[model samples]
Target: MTPPPTDKVVPLDELGDLVADGESVAFGGGWFANHPMAAVRQLIRAGRKDIHAITVVGSVDMDLLAAAGVLGHLSFSMVTLEAFGLAPNVRKAIETASVPFTEYTGLGLLIGLEAQGRGMPFLPYRGPFGSDLPARYPEIYATTTCPFTGEELTAVRALQPDVAIVHALRCDAEGNAQWDGTSGPDVDMAKAARRVIVTCEEIVDRSVIAQNPHMTKLPGYYVDAVVEAPFGAHPTSHIPRYSMDAWELMDYAGQAGTDEFGGYVDRIRSESEDDYRARVLTGRDVVLAALVDAAETLEGANL
Candidate 1:
């Protein structure tokens, strides 16, 4: 008889302990969907600093970290708040040259992670033609010729982050994570990272995960730790469970880059995750869940 598997479960507060200052960290999620906001908050609350953040399409998650003075370097394809406006903190940091940054084309960034996941030094593809990005980063991008056809292709170097944090719908104690919707770049980012931390709305027993194996995107072997954080992706949408808290985002947008922004960051730093939920998510959580139900109802009616 085999002994029980090691329980990878950990408290959210320990998230900061896994990451070191100045280490490259790949944040999972894209375009305000399923970002590890809980972990992001924990990092700030723990007073972690000088993080080198990487994202494919970031929004508030990146901006909040920037506002908290946690970022020393940023590498990304895009960081926008969509209807709210640009990511003010990131933009200001870049404009002031306070945070060094590298801007990759969206495809280039994904391919770089893919290269690492596949154990390759680099991967070649028909990259963005006539884009000035290639010329700017010679070390990352280069023109290569196919040995057989002599066709010119662009090559992207591997991008392996020191750690990756992703939000899942649910995970087991052994760290098997499942996502009901909008996994985004979580899989690729997890694959390319040296260590992975999974924060989920709930942590179930291994039997629960086994019941729905199809939903398990990241197996336990790839995950270093599992954190149970209900509403882990608040403000960012975690489909099927709840929609984004647009009101919170709008409020954040208004305060960002203003004198009040420091207070906002300070509140997050001072509170526990439970306190944050109590303060901001109390009455709003129900409405956010209703929004998801309403959208699904509309979609079903349309069908």
Candidate 2:
């Protein structure tokens, strides 16, 4: 995988330039898979604040941002650390009233992003009427009469994120990304956001991309910047690449339980990407080590 030109390809340190201050943001991946952790780290290191983070189910991405006190608002159905238990940072933020937030059903969040992607003002969603979400977050979830059936439906306002970022298995020199497993809301985020950033494990030749065009989840045109960041989704699984680093996640969960979350973030932010790879990711996989080397070489050239 050769490096793409400087016009579209950027080093991880330069990622902040693509996003402005106090803008809404959407992230790709679900649960603990395919998250753009490397880019997220850069965002945190850059001191980005007042961000409105949007996702159907918030996980480590949301937890990290909230812990750093960078997020001003959140739009999600729920925040879970998954099997690790509750996301302490989000819980603390809400309990302390640190950030203004909204709660919506999983379907409601998806429909909202979809509406924004399609350039619609609002999307009609059914079945959330049984819950109290409509009464609680009326600003996000509203009720409207169906023109034909006259059945009342929940209207979810469109969410146009200022910037969206995603992690991919591979991308061509032109920024066509290939994601191996479930896409979740990544496609919607790409379409809904004004700008898109793609962080990938490797850069394959354009010919490889042409062989299986069907696998290209994010077309090049939508992507504003392409970064080669192997192990970019570290601590999170990337399907065919590797599984989640439960040890690191457990460490995070442990730190998040106390006031040591800032120390945890500081330690990681201080380490070089190579040091992080040796300490966390390269214990059993030599292949991942090779990929990391390749990605570093590409990123170093830009730096």
Per-residue C-alpha lDDT of model 1 across residues 1-303, encoded as one tens digit per residue: 989987999999888899999899999999979999999999999888999999999999999999999999999999999999999999999999999999999999999999999899999999998999989999999999999999999999999999999999999988899999999999999999999999999999999999999999999999999999999999998988889888999999999989878999988999999999999999989999999888733345554
* Residue 13 miss distance in model 2 (angstroms): 1.4
Per-model tally of clashing residue pairs: 0, 0
Q: Which lDDT values do the candidates have, in the order given?
A: 0.94, 0.81
Q: In candidate 2, what are the lDDT values of residues 1-303, reduced to their tens digit? A: 966543577888888777777999898888887778887787887878898888777688889988877799988887888999999999988899989888878888888888998999999967576787778877777889899999988898998899989888888767898987756788888888999888888888878988999999888988888888888888776767777767778888988968666787786667766677777766645554344344432345554
lDDT of residue 7 for candidate 2: 54
Predicted structure 2: lDDT: 0.81
Q: Which regions of candidate 2 deviate over 4 angstroms?
A: 1-7, 284-303
Residue 239 of model 1 has an lDDT of: 89
